[model samples]
Target: MKPGLLALVCVAFLATLPPVDAFAAPAPSLPEAGYAPLKMTIGGETRCLTADGDETKSWQYVALKACEDGSRLQNWKLKSIGNARYFIFNEYFGEKRYLRTYSKASSIALDSDTSGYSTMRSWEVSNGALNDIRLWNVYSRDIGQWKTLDADPQSQSVGISIPGGTRVDVWQYGIDMPTPQFPVAGTRKILVMATHFSDETSADSAPVRDTVLGVFGTPYYEDRSARNYLMQASGERLTPNMDFLDEVDIGERPDACNASQILSAARDAARHREKNPQDYDYLFVSIRQWRQCPWVGLASVPGNWVLAQGSSAHKFWTWTHEFGHALGFHHARILYGCPPRDGVAQLGGDCTTYNYGKAPTDPMGGGGASMFPVAYQHFAGWLSDADVPWIKHDGTYKLDPLWRRGSAAQGYRIRRSDGSVLFVEFRRPSQPFETWWGASPYVSGVTVYVVNYAPKARSMTSTLVNTTPGSGRSMGDAPLLPNHSLDDTLSGMRLTVTLAHNDGAELKVEKLPK
Candidate 1:
């Protein structure tokens, strides 16, 4: 502790001291830093975007960034800066909203304040010539005006309609799936639950309905079914339409342990999707190793009907409906105007009576009818108009299917419309014999346009049979339901499909009399 030694030590320590901020990287400055304000399509209509010259590459002119409904152009966080750079958003449609950011920066040059958008409209870029990258957001928004968007406010998911007898086979790859290729909306998520079906359910106790995802075995939603349903629904509601995605069935696995396996499968599927350029989307699944107690026999949702150890009918239904969630169809809100029982609105609509009263028609909303066919075929995707035609919950032109998965994800061949061959695998799942006349809003009903075909579906001759209504079991007021089954043959030379609806709608169905 000598004074001279202490002074020497202090000087040495001071010499070794680190510089104040030498090694640290400096934060971006206000002018040099970037900000990401959210842009939203209020009602799936239009979104308003604003940015300053500082943030935009075009520092001289105001930058005009174009955005689509449910489509965001940047993964940005807001940083309050100048007056021209502020954040404001609102929703016009229901509750859902989405944001997307471009992988590359889009340059939008504006001349001035009032001329911001208008001038940008005439803005040009090139090796010197003008480019034809047509977009709607170049010059639309005012300082704080609400932007108008035209993208369809509906979501273009997928739709399904299978028959009770239609066998559930794993879609083998590198093989000819040779399906109808009705353009789908978003990525398709598959949920396999084969072990939960029952043979005795017969078509009798089945519920009446429409084409949609239906479940029969293991009650409505088991751990597998419920988890899959939630994942698909969440993705649909949250993620905007992207290039690729799908859900699939898992082999026999325990319900409780299925979560991890399902997540693993989704990851694998996602990786595989990269090969197809359809890899930029979301996926969900439930792999069943064996029936675990936590997930075994659980309700698909709340009051689902598919129970464990059922028949093929139930199993088929499960696949159909759970897939529906991935496809983007919300459950029928009893309050939305469905038949209410005892004050509680029943989702499955009204039940039809049948078979002496030994059994009642299903009321869960997912179809279970043996006749009338109008029943919601849990196996059917119950496509809504918005889910079809490649529209967002808010409408917009979907070019991904046409540009990316076009030839592979879709194609059309004309076989002289003869009874010999026509009506390829429609990919539509129905109850025994059901046909969808309308488009599902949840599916990409566009993309696939057919010129002509023979009537292998027999829908031309197939009439809706009005069967006796189930007595007390009947939920709908109709004493008769529509008959969907048919076995007939017809042919035609050519057919022109104008447009396809997303709700499993058949665009062109013209055939010659047999």
Candidate 2:
């Protein structure tokens, strides 16, 4: 090729090569960026950094106090001050006033005294030991001290300190979430198998398969029993694949009808089949007779066994309720301890089993007639953000019945600044379960509950906010009706149902002044 042509080609190729950093966007500086607020909990209490005493005080000592939702005093604004440092400002106060530590030993205080940004008023946030979050003091510019927001053990008040191993629980206050567990996507297939001993005739085994298929496979569960309605409302769909392995000759033994024996036989039979055993997600075993058992089913994690009997043959809610366990449902007992009712003595102590045969509105609590509570629905991944809206500010909202499919919100979650939450929903008596159980006037209405997420203990407590003072069975299922308002004076929130209907309801919520 000619020298001029070669030179031209090389020049064109060079022009085509992109310049350095062509696709890169400039990173924003921290000082110019904003941050979300943080809720800090220590010593099992939610604490807010406060400018204690008169608001007009120039240098009021910053102290810890009980966290209150929507309280400007409890809301701390974290502002970036460049180079991994942050200035914590109390929203209760206006501009420039920031939390500052006067000396290493002095109590933390709020001051507008600084003419310019001070590193002594800045802090560094980082992960600490045992999953705890730590904040470091950037005052000396040496990163020397573990500055912590501490709370008094007795009064649960907050202050600044060089913390020891004590970990501070830090999280955003209003982030709503579902219960954490293994999730089942799409529709799940459940296998129902009926077993017969060597001595038993095919005639005796007929009831087992007949009842299993009739109850689970047909509309008995889906429409008539209200099981599928409950699950589908939560975004879980289950299809019962009834496989009647009638009169499988398990060698004679008195314990053959036991739960373990039945599970083993069913597993063996499934493995021996041409189809792979793992194809089935659940195993339901049925026997001929009953020996005065609880007339319930047993679930061993992913595997579930239903001991169906003639007495409770048509009461299929028992089986459906047990399968709820396999799907990762905890008993819908009164999550928090409930006080005495009608001189019957208080039941449900710290979630311990006390009130069985109560709570007819929840299947987990011997109430086969009622649907699962919003708490269980949230935990079971049934209520998505679309269904349950988290209310960050005060507003009037419309809600549909939790079971009905609609574009409207089924529930509203009002999160207190302290990380507690209020869940409001509408409940009614319409399903077959409710009709069969004779809808309790107390349960068929609107409901409100308070959920306390205890970080230190790694547990959640759900307390029902009663509608009729003490009319509910155990944890109380009755919801407040239209034109009725219930107030949580502590959280400064009032929920009033303006209109109630078979399909939905409208709620007017007011964040009352403390």
Q: What is the TM-score of each candidate against the true structure?
A: 0.24, 0.56
List, in order, the clash count of every candidate structure. Answer: 129, 5
Top candidate on TM-score is: 2
Worst 10 residues of 1 by lDDT: 5-14
Query: lDDT by residue for model 2 over 122-209, one digit each (tens)?
Result: 7655432112344455553233554565556565545656666443424332312322222333444456555545666533555554
Give the C-alpha lDDT of model 1.
Answer: 0.23
Estimate the TM-score for candidate 1: 0.24
Candidate 1 C-alpha error for residue 437, in Å: 17
User: Candidate 1 residues 334-398, lDDT tens each?
Assistant: 11222433332222224221222111111122342211111121112222212223111212122
In angstroms, give how far residue 8 of model 2 lies from its true place.
Answer: 90
